[model samples]
Target chain A: MARAQELAMRDYVQEVSALTMRWVHRLRREKFSMLFTLVQPMLFWLIFFGSLFQRAANSEVMQAPNYMSFLAAGVVVMTVLNNGLSGGVDLLFDKENGFLERLLATPIHRSSVIISRFIFVMTITSLQILVILTVAYFFGVHPATGLLGIAVVLLIGMLFGIGLTALSMAMAFTVKSHGDFFSVLGFLSLPLIFLSSALVPLSAMPTWMSMLARFNPMTWTIDAVRPLILSGWSQALPRIGMVVMLLLVFDALCLYGSTRAFRRAIG
Target chain B: MGRTVAIETLKLAKAFGDVKAIEHLSFQVWEGEIFGLLGPNGAGKSTTLRILLTLLRPTAGHATVFGHDVVQEPDRVRRLIGYVPQERAIDRFLTGREHLLLLGSLYHLPKDETLRRIREILKLVDLEDRADHLAKTYSGGMKRKLDLACGLLPNPKVLFLDEPTLGLDVQSRLRIWDYIRRLKERGITVVMTTNYLDEADHLCDRLAIIDGGRIMALGSPAELKAGLGGDVVSLTVGAADMDRVESLAKSLKAVPSIRAISTKPSGIDIRVESPEKALPAILDAANQQACRLEFIEYHRPRLEDVFIAQTGHAIREEFPSGE
Candidate 1:
């Protein structure tokens, strides 16, 4: 029985890896799109846009050593958010192109598709996060809490992204077409970023905006990552624990919603 | 036929809210024979195929693939069957070989075995030369050939093809048909759904004509035509002369050996016991009425005739659209 169970587990793993490789192969084939993904988020935005706000956010009210250092944490978390929110687009395209229908007919665990989507989006997003940090490093941004803090920042980014990515997948299954999904992505991403402390300090923001940003998960993720980059562990550790707890609750809801959508679409 | 039963459905039914996609659907597909579900669009053919593939659950009744219940033992059923849906399911990003490799992994075949079968299937589909090219680079026919190669990856005991040749040019359709026949030769049970009368008549060993979520007629092509017990003599008349066309039909009803007559847009069809004796009287009637005959046609009864006789309408009612 144990051997049989192991075989079954191995089969499930094989199916998931195969499905995941399909997406990776797609990314590999679209060299221009991938190149665009890596270059667009780091070079233009970090150097140009970050410099625009560098001196403005260095005041005591902002409570940061410099704007470039502050925005590094935001950029890392934003990359994760960007990758996670649009992660559903590929699955939506697959649904439109009828590949999802075909996949369901094959002898595979249905969860494999969902799991593979999660792994693919997270891996790509994580790599993009690392790229954002490396590029920011050249710009004189470092994690004040050192190597361990860098790992924590990555962990927080991933934990924060899991729920949003799940929500994006749910949207993929819910929307009628890729056009509708893009609209949904646009509707959520920019608003969430603006409402968070990513671009401007919550202390410097207007009263109403700060009230709204208090509940935004992006703000939570950015705030947790910010200290690791500028203020180090004394200020970052407790925030990390609180952010992880809230994210767990958020991801559970998103996963439940996504599973329902997945079942509804395929069933 | 005293062959092994590969698939069976009893009182199967499915509904989407208030709309009934299929109901009271029952049939048996014998092993080693090509079976067909002949129906028009929305005739529940694809829905039935989906249920057998365990992609959808039936609202009522039971279906089994090689005695494995679709709902209760879906894993086993999936193991025994491979299904090609009515839509094109290829990814333009991947090459032909990549698609099969993915399928192999989904089926959990060993690495060396999958590699070996990929080579054999690529060759069988005549896609060995273009196996490395991206599917976006392949022609419509080549993509369809690759689709067929994917369905054959697991060497399934039963293959369900939903309108396998639904949207292909004549040569491509013919090539797909040839592949389907080859599968049957290898003792693989093929169950396809099509509205193309010629496809069903030419390829299927036995077929069930389904309409409005029900089977209207079920038999071999020859048997169904023979059951009509007559030859269908089609008399063509010009549309400009509608009055003469009705009078022609009215006069033909009095003739002996004529079983039935139905008037159509461009012509009238007469089901007679023998066209040999009925042609003289039909021509005599046309001549008496001075009905200018554009053409006259007679042949052994076709699946269309059987479909018309059973359903009281042409299967081509909606432009031969795919489900």
Candidate 2:
């Protein structure tokens, strides 16, 4: 029984931590990519795209102090969405290069592969969101909910990221090549972002567009996050419950799909 | 006589959808010996290795490692095995030491023991000096060494190497071959797959020559080659005529020292008891046949000859000489 218990400890927490650190170590060695991760959202999205509509987008319809502040939340969640979607690129490359086969042959809890991926993606996404929020503060957009609210905002982003990561991993296992995955990403990302309240308020979108955006998990997450940055819990609390419940269902469906995909692919 | 079996497959078969990868393959791996599966690219060598590693389930047979069923008890099977795949399996950004350290934990070695083992393994693979360097900085040979080091982190009882020396320079291939030879000294049973004739001939104590998902022959290299009767003297005739080759073969059969006669695409092969005494007689027969002799050569039987004797085709046909 003692030996049995020793074997039980063989794989979960230990394997996940080691694998997650492996991902972090890879990122650290690639200094150029790490530096770009910090600045890309601020440069491409907040500074340029946010500025395009800053003076034009009405503040009342956006439900924020200004369009840049409203777009700040959108950018954070967009970063999360992008990071989550690309989370499985490493695993796919591993598969193509034969590391995945090597990994699978080892005596590991196979689920640790997925768990480590989740931890790695979330950690990087958190760091990117922090940088984006810091840059937004420089643009005069402090969270109305302050320090505790920022934690809550990060938590909401993470909850939203979990579902996207699972779906992305499913795509990784299902698709034949990274080229196919990128094509799938192009097809999904822009339409989902444009249709949602990320760049424009849902209230301002065409009825047909709004109907589609209502079904997007991204829209639900952005709606929940937009208020936390612009208003306190009192305004954000009601939407938070609905979005959390919605995300739970969304994550369950994605998790189920990805579990099947993973089993089929690995087997 | 009380030898132990390390691995055994009982009429193992596997199919991917409609395509059969392995068919009724049966073999036993004796303990503490280097066993090789020799085959071409699509010959089910990797598939057999994968099934034994418990990475793939066989469609219609059973495989066991140390008496544990691979399909039913993979965790037990896995704990006893390590795999180095065809490619060098390393993350380019991770240092050699980092890869080993992570593998140490992944294999569930205790913290202090993992550190101790890492030190020992780095030294063993001669990576101690470059241990702190990222894998990308390493040469192709160095990357393969790091991969081998990681495979040893678990101290597995049986190690699976799929095409261990593949795609390496001759020097690097020799180095890896040296490493594999030493693995036997450490008493780790090795199961490797390779299509390279020299890799199998020099390294394996015994091997199975497989093709089209079936074993064509199985024995020690010496045993299999010795089964070819005797030395082979191949005469490459300049003509493309099969009838002329057959006629020459018929004429060559009359030579007193010749044991057997066979036809090749470009010439005739005569198995002789001894090439030296038969050389003059065979040359006389060739001279009488009045066919222009392109080239004539004789050598002790090689494993390739054994494969040809069993399967009627050269294994080297898969790879052109340039590759």
The model with the greatest lDDT is 1
Which regions of candidate 2 are displaced past 4 Å?
A1-7, A37-39, B238-244, B254-259, B273-284, B287-295, B318-323
DockQ of each: 0.78, 0.73
Q: State which docking tier applies to candidate 2.
A: medium
Q: Model 2 over residues A1-267: C-alpha lDDT tens digits?
A: 998877677556788899899898888788697678545844589988878888898988887778899899889888888888888888888877888877788778999888999999898888788888998899898998998888888898889889999999998999989999999987988887888888888888999999999998888898888888898789899989999999899889989999999998888
Candidate with best DockQ: 1
CAPRI class assigned to model 1: medium
Mark the regions of model 1 whose C-alpha exceeds 4 Å error after superposition: B237-242, B265-267, B287-294, B318-323
Clashing residue pairs, backbone N/CA/C < 3 A, model 2: none
